[model samples]
Target: MTQPNTQIPDFQSIMLPMLNLLESGEVFTLNQVVTKLAEHFHLSKEDLKIKVPSGQMGLFRNRVGWTRSYLKKAGLIHYPERAKYQITPFGKDYLKGKPKDLRIKHLKKMPDYIEWTKTFNQDTNNKQEAEITKEIESQTPEEVLASTVDQLNKQLATDLLDKLKENSFGYFENFVIELLQKMGYGEFREDAAERTGQTGDNGIDGIISQDRLGLENVYIQAKRFRDGHVGSPDIRNFIGSLALQGVNKGVFLTTSRFSESAIKTASDSKQQKIILIDGKQLANLAIEYNLGVQVDKTIAIKKIDLDYFEE
Candidate 1:
């Protein structure tokens, strides 16, 4: 069956209606919000069923997630649990005005919102520069394919981080193990890798044998630090521990970014080979390797038939 090309309203357009849904100060799960907003916008069943390019979830759900994310960042809403939020006191106050201009510009007034927007814009700029190449008409086939591919990958990466944070430490350790395995470290899959976080081996999370016989090893440290940046102290401690174990290779993975000093520390360690994987890089790797991702669909763009003109 052919999918419809219908469009749902952008996040900015849904912002006001969404805030109004929670304006009464009642808590709602994401499903409730998505359903109510869909009704308000009068989206058809088919429209609500439109899957994102990843085919993981409906596209509308993805947009609504962003709507909640942006609002949550601006301090207008608070998450009581995963995918559930209660309107904030500030949210009620702002809704009292029945805001018509709840655009991103207005959201930027909040410092948190500014930071969130910066991260999102940076991702977009990165993809745009690499994939799009040059501006073309929206009707252009190449432009459409490249643009959608870029957007889908960005969404996938963001969602991966979101889900990873909600998981347990054991889950995260296994996730990192799986990621490395998918990255071609699975040749010695039998006993090559195991979680050591449970044993608390000098802050090392896991170790992957570089060879099946365990001749060489790569120490793994996975930190699911959600908020704070990993600094030089963390890197130095990991490296010092590696030296104590007489290991030369280590991989440090974090769901947060590493500070410049931390990055520099790894670079300056000539005795040990260290690789730092940030949340963004980790997600991108997962996407590239299909670790927690799948191919949604492939698009082919055909050009004019020059043979017809020659004839």
Candidate 2:
């Protein structure tokens, strides 16, 4: 009996097999590609089910995603649709050499791959040296990719906050109203949000209808601060404003972070539920809800057809 291979293949090790699997130019889904690679590597059920460090998904599945991401970066694969991918002519030609394995070193030989590397790390202007590339090669593709995404999002958030500071208080109010709508507030209705960031509103900027029938209301206290923190006094005042209005829930959003005391004040409130959204949280929400963002590009991962073996 052949013992199941206990070792899980890294993203680079999975690259060659991934390309070969897609070489037929057939549109394959990511799941299909994962299964083919698992079978090709003779991974046991246990091996296939291993979890990544985050444990949000199976490690093998993450590796499969990274494998596809790398191939897509190298121009070996292209997504024909949202969830479908196929190999390109260049990929097919590259496979003619029958390279036993694909590695970062080998990828650097390709102009598209090199360009893709630069594109992947957009903020980094310097060309990646051998050491940096090798270090990246050491980690699983998902790890590198996730870190890259986080960095990009952080930079974007900083830029977004700067822009927010430049806008008028009225613009900030409208932005929040639209943002809440995108986040499924008020059932995503255009009229779900009402801007009341006017004077004499008792620190309340706006109000959001929790339901289409308007049975409940979520008060919004939008603060557009540049560098100052939203301190405990601000939170207590908002909590007081909620009390005066007979409202129980409020969102105190600021383009700045909350002090420890402020966070504690919100948490320690027994009768009121105050949700604190800081600058970073606000920026990420904007990105997630696609307020001012647009889809840059999409990559599709592919897997094998299981029914082919059922018969």
Candidate 3:
């Protein structure tokens, strides 16, 4: 009978030395480990990409942080101060009689190392299992779409709440404008002071085309509110301004929120269609368009060529 294949040591094996060095009570920073580990292992800085120390200046900060976190969780290391880490007593004991088989699976049996493998694996498995169950339950296209939209709305509301904490109202307004533009209302423009009427002199903040041409328009009123829901009277005043402009549509945007009555009054009007965008909806739109943000990196994976396998 054939024996099981042995597992090989990888980046984690290389990190063990750095951990050992820290256990010796020598004061060293993440930068010091990056350089020293590279030299001791006879590997170039590029080779250390998979094992650089956490939060250090490099492209591998994420990987380094993961490794550090795992080591700490296993009781091999502890943080002495913010961003400063040191090896534990358990790590020192392991270093004295280090195991010859340095595979990660074998490392779990070390006296100092707690078995986080089972716990971490179970947590990940549970999340994936829940997602699978959800997918199995959502058998129809409409169900899937509805679920996705609901998720989008919840995410938007949560993000808006987070932004409220930051108190960046101007950024929030610009975020809303970008969202509407992305929804194919590209003909929209900020209203001039002269065009703004009572409600307040500059009440209507923007104007959007009902169609491609400028003939039909939808007036917009944006308020950077922090407290209290917009009342029915606010909606009445907005509709009055829309009527003055001879427009059938109006959009009322607020950062705080709108009362149920305000939403009903806006939609209840038989002659006009007034759109109400509260803080929750605004966040959802921002996320959909990816406004004010850009992805910094992308990764692509490819399969090995199979033609050589037949040779």
Q: How many clashing residue pairs appear in each of the predictions shown? A: 0, 10, 0
Q: State the lDDT of candidate 2 residue by residue for 1-311, as single tens digits.
A: 22323498877888898899998999998788888888999988888767865455788887788777667656788777766789999999999998887876677767665543332333334445576778788989789878877865765665576578678988888887788878888865667778887779988999999988777999999888855578999999999999999989999887767888999999999878999988778888999989877766555547798988897
True lDDT of residue 114, candidate 2: 57
Tens digits of per-residue lDDT for model 1, 128-245: 3324445545347666777777876776786687678778888999999888987878455677888889775887888888787888888999988756678999999999989988
**Whole-model Cα lDDT per candidate?**
0.80, 0.79, 0.59
Question: For residues 125-159, what per-residue lDDT tens digits would candidate 3 score against the true structure?
Answer: 33444576687586786676577556545534543
For model 3, which pairs clash?
Answer: none
**Which ranges in model 2 have alpha carbons more than 4 Å from their true place?**
1-137, 301-311
Give the Å shift of residue 8 in candidate 2. Answer: 36
RMSD of each: 5.3, 15.7, 14.0
How far off is residue 210 in model 2, in Å?
1.2
Q: What 10-residue stretch in candidate 1 is worst by lDDT?
A: 123-132
Candidate 1 CA-lDDT value: 0.80
Q: Sort every candidate by lDDT, greatest first.
A: 1, 2, 3
Better-scoring candidate (TM-score), 1 or 3:
1
Q: Identify the superior model by TM-score, candidate 1 or candidate 2.
A: 1
